[model samples]
Target: MHPAGPAAKVIATLWWVLLGGATAIFLFVAGLIAWAWYGPSGERDEWGYVIGLGLVFPLIVLAALLAYGLVVGERLLPRPGPDVVRVQAEARQWAWRFGYDDAPDRETENVLHIPAGRPVDVAITTADVIHAFWVPRLAGKLDAVPGRVNVLRIEADRPGRYEGLGSEFNGPGYRDHRFSVIAHDAASWDRFLQGDAP
Candidate 1:
């Protein structure tokens, strides 16, 4: 499936760019090898072409990619916004607990509910060993460490469900450490906050 929001979209774009660049590099090197084996012997030792393609081109491409990556990463960071919602994610041995900042008493296990078409800042930490919160369709993964709190911002383009899990290997129950993200429309999200739904 395609990415649902801006952050995931940026990541997807970066992935495609990397794949294309790698493929191009591979083809160029392969072509050079073929030419060396089968083309005119006198022209096979072209220093200028070898140096330019093997050194200069890669350096330029790598520098450009590094700059592009930094720009995309900066865009994905959590920023203060008027309608931003905050949630806290706590990780244990093999389970996840989500607490809403707006409704302190309301907590849910293994299911995160948020409003669609808006940004959500998820504060993540671990009660036990380290874990990683990863929801592929929405945003990138963030580490959940015992004594550290990391915030990851995510958004859903529409009302739907997305899967998430602890990406890092912890212990015996690591494989079962899974969760779901449920995105609701504005009214449904309000009702959820007001405790009208379980």
Candidate 2:
């Protein structure tokens, strides 16, 4: 078999990177579309469109690098570690409760603590009428209904404070069915787990 020439090798590399990058970009775009159209109010914004545009050029550069790695040489894509967290939530007549596996006994009212840069799975269920759980900054939303559990995944890329509002109208307090999501590092997470906050 003949060895690939320099130009051929480069072209192949570019193609491979392009494919990977395109895949990533496609997923990102899909998320954006879901967010803008189907996601909650906070997700729909003109700034998101602008931000999407800004990412195009950089995405192209990464795609090129990925292509080069695949065609010209073998490169291992760095997989982010398994840093996913799960927070189970239950909906009752007039409130929401959050619990972590390690600390299931502790319940927080309308406040959820999650680790940043990690995938979070929220299993939601309702004790009564249907309720929706939503957090715009992290990801999309899902419904919480009686006798059923809904799974929602969120990945907060950055650490900060975000808001979550129930998209469903249940009762008079439906408007008050809002909460705050606090994304923190490992240290803060530990503290929260220890019940050190108000």
Candidate 3:
């Protein structure tokens, strides 16, 4: 239900699947324990249970989950694409400075603009202490450390305004550190890039 973009959809699906898998494993183990304790005690295959159920089951389940999670994570990475938009997000003090690749001189404070229905790669960095860039409705969170740039891929399915924030506790003013992302239509985005729209 929180799926606003492709990456967000993938992440939400992974979360649900992981929760389902965890619930299934819990119930299975609980039922098995109940059966073993309440049922009639006979000659049990100690080695078989130990090897097959304990070791093999956990290994197989963990391996499958790991593989699935890695695949999902790889899919969410910022891949090279022709239509991908690039922007710079620099965190300092309690504000976000956004610079568009299309416009070198143009800069916005605490507000980011992008074209809707297109992949946007945000190169995040910090000028001062460590902070985090998080836009829950668009994509996942990534830390912004000094001297390091971490790129995050985000997209919006439609034209709207999405809220973003600095998730790390860099200082006392971090509580009010917030931003907004304005996803514009194709024409509006073009106008905005040409210094027509704000």
Quick one: best TM-score, which candidate? 1
User: For residues 7-102, what per-residue lDDT tens digits would candidate 2 score against the true structure?
Assistant: 233334455666777777677777776766776675345775757654765577676666566544432211234665778888876778898975
Q: Where's the lowest-lDDT run of ten residues in candidate 3? A: 53-62
TM-score of 1: 0.95
Model 3 regions lying over 4 Å from their true place = none
Q: Which ten residues in a row have the lowest lDDT in candidate 1?
A: 40-49
lDDT of each: 0.91, 0.70, 0.90
| Model 3 steric clash pairs | none
Ranking by lDDT: 1, 3, 2
Q: After superposition, how far is residue 151 of candidate 2 from its true place, in Å?
A: 0.8
TM-scores, one per candidate: 0.95, 0.57, 0.93
Over 4 Å off in model 1, which ranges?
43-46
10 residues in a row with least lDDT, candidate 2: 1-10
**Which candidate number would show the highest lDDT if scored against the true structure?**
1
